[model samples]
Target: MDKIINSPYNINAVARVDSDNIVHNHIYHYCPIGRVDDNNFIYDNNNNVVGRVDDDGIVHNHSINNSPIGKVLENGFVIKENALVGRVDGDNLLLAGAAYLLLIQGNR
Candidate 1:
């Protein structure tokens, strides 16, 4: 199954996560370092470990002292600093930092 990450208003697709757990947009692609599940580190196209999703659904940025950057709530909403930034459609992967990986760092 594939997960579609949409904008806050659910307008456009921000990124598409395929069955292999690889996230891809027109400009960039991010893949998991270990397994395709929780507690796994996410890497960018350059194979840099950008962030990670914890078991609690919290997204952490490795470059920023592993701070809690965002949260993937149980309701499928992606929250960043208490604001609705994006949403995941389909079975939640519980990837701690997938939204932050695609929305913020993926743009860099």
Candidate 2:
């Protein structure tokens, strides 16, 4: 679905982009994990299993057929496929790969 997630910077919302990689101005769903902990399951607006994060700070995207998107490093850098995506802010909010390859990519 062509989607765009307009979320608060700290909230870290994920969006499903279209074939052209454009994030349309629409929200399909958001980070079901309002507050993240460990082993949280990510979901779409349809409430389908999108992906998940492990306790070790690894991001796994089931939305793309069980793929390894990125991981949260010790320095609080959220790197996706070796590229610097985002990071955990002071409030410990994980923000990363929304509007790109994931709807939301983080420790959530």
TM-score of each: 0.75, 0.50
Candidate 2 contains a number of clashing pairs equal to 3
Candidate whose TM-score is highest: 1
Model 2 spans > 4 angstroms off = 1-38, 90-108
Clashing pairs in 1: 53-96, 59-96
Worst 10 residues of 2 by lDDT: 91-100
Residues 1-108, model 2: lDDT tens digits: 332333334556334334333233224343332221233555444556666666676777776787777776666556676776554433222322231333343334
lDDT by residue (1-108, candidate 1, tens digit) is 777776668457656667776766622444332223344677665667767878788888777888888888887778888877777777765653355443364455
Predictions in order: lDDT:
0.64, 0.46
**Each model's RMSD to truth, in Å?**
3.6, 9.8
